[model samples]
Target: MARHTAFAAICVGICAAGATLGGCDRPAETAAPADVFLANVAEYCGKAFSGRVVANEPPADADPFADKNLVMHVRGCEQPSRELRIPFHVGDDRSRTWILSRTDSGLRLKHDHRHEDGSEDKVTIYGGDTVDSGSATRQEFPVDRESVALFQREGLKASVENTWAMEIHPGNIFAYELTRPGGRKFRVEFDLTEATELPPPPWGHE
Candidate 1:
């Protein structure tokens, strides 16, 4: 009887300590980086931001984006955490939409290019999947096999090895970047401090 009573008292003491220290309950698991990243970008749903080309190495003599207004509309967020569609507008051209979605392994990024008539471009839907667990504010995607085959078929062999990355600093800046071998670097940064007028939907989305 004495041993049982002592054991009961010890258990009671342990329980009291657990109650105070929260050690008895299992700790909540932290979200994976990919999930956190998706959630981070989803916060901008229904907003629009203006961007400018910040880096363009091997500058072209006739830059397509030069002096052109650039806008990114974060829309199509019915399933914000699962998928997001951001339309990238360059002046009068409204043919590009960036699709970000969560995959079983990690995340995926795809480009949807369309013609003015709403037809899919020949080299459309080409992008990549995240190869690792990027941070909550940034992710890198290497060109996938499917994209490589499409690029090869389209005679865009140089793009087969492309790597695309995105960075989001809440209330500060959102950046889109692309890099490849041979010193190719292109980046566009959007000011997240100011929300701009939402642009029209990309081709075929309207």
Candidate 2:
């Protein structure tokens, strides 16, 4: 009976040791860089900021932002879903929503464009996921496979190599940037120090 008791004790010790070893071998998961950027953006929830096209002459096409009203409303923060749906108003069009989501690998930024009747545009949902964990205030997302395919289908071959970036300067500026290798660099910065009234619900959001 004493020998049997000793054997049982040894088995329990072995199991505990194995469990400890397994735990030590596993690395801990950390918050993604995109999530950090998203948190920074969330700080402006329920606020509206107006901006203008900083670039004198945007390349690749004629500037559609000339003398147009531009407003961005950060509203409806969904923490549980890890998504921040920020509506971007260009001129009289309120049909654009920038969807930021935290994925397993990184954060994804999708541009959701809708018509006046809430119908999705054929070229909507074209955005990319962060390829790396950038700084807390900034994250860059290169063209993802899905976005590339969409561009190809839409005959937008020039946009296949595009990359988008968002930067938050905390009380200074919040800028959205787009670059395509050596193609073009477009940026628009909102005034963080002076927030306007929240805009109405995006075209289809209501």
Candidate 3:
């Protein structure tokens, strides 16, 4: 009887250990679906997008493309916008390129300003608040202070307030817009139709 009881207790101990291990693994399995979806979105965004800046606020004084090309592409759209790159130009001059991504805390925006000779002017990173809008995600970063200095340094005499908006369409397009304090707005709509193949970044050079 003593031997039988001892055997039963050992069996119960083994079952308890198995149960504990199973419970520990459950959370990982439950999170897999979300991880997979985000991974897919990131993969899609990793492709370079070729599109024109269809609109702008305050309008460019001269031809928008006469200087250089203003094009945008996504590096990745996962939790981290890891390798996303955006380029802006002024008369054959690539003035600025922005690298940004999403994080658990919020959205991160990095600006790489360059001179005509391919020299780095300034590198700055800005963070903002992010919100999900179901079909699309919106990121709002305060520009009142940062814009004042950045715009001045960049030789753009624009006093902007309120927020900058970046909306992702999940598929092939991403839209960027800036809303100033006085209600003046600038928008860039990126259409991916002309994109033959997606390239990796630094503006995804073919």
Query: What are the Cα lDDT values of the candidates?
Result: 0.83, 0.74, 0.47
- The C-alpha TM-scores of every prediction are 0.86, 0.80, 0.56
Ranking by lDDT: 1, 2, 3
Error of 1 at 194 (Å): 0.5
Better of 2 and 3 by lDDT: 2
Candidates ranked by TM-score = 1, 2, 3
The ten-residue window of minimal lDDT in model 2 covers 19-28
Ten residues in a row with the worst lDDT in model 1?
19-28
User: Tens digit of lDDT per residue, candidate 3, span 35-72?
Assistant: 22222334434445545555665566785554444556
Which candidate leads the pack in TM-score? 1
Error of 2 at 89 (Å): 0.5
lDDT of 2 by residue, 1-206 (tens): 43233223333432354422123222212333454466567777789999977753245356677778899888867551366888989888899898887676677889999999989999999899887778767888898899899999999998999998888877788988888865588888899999997777898899
Backbone clash pairs for candidate 2 read: none
Error of 2 at 189 (Å): 0.2
TM-score, candidate number 3: 0.56
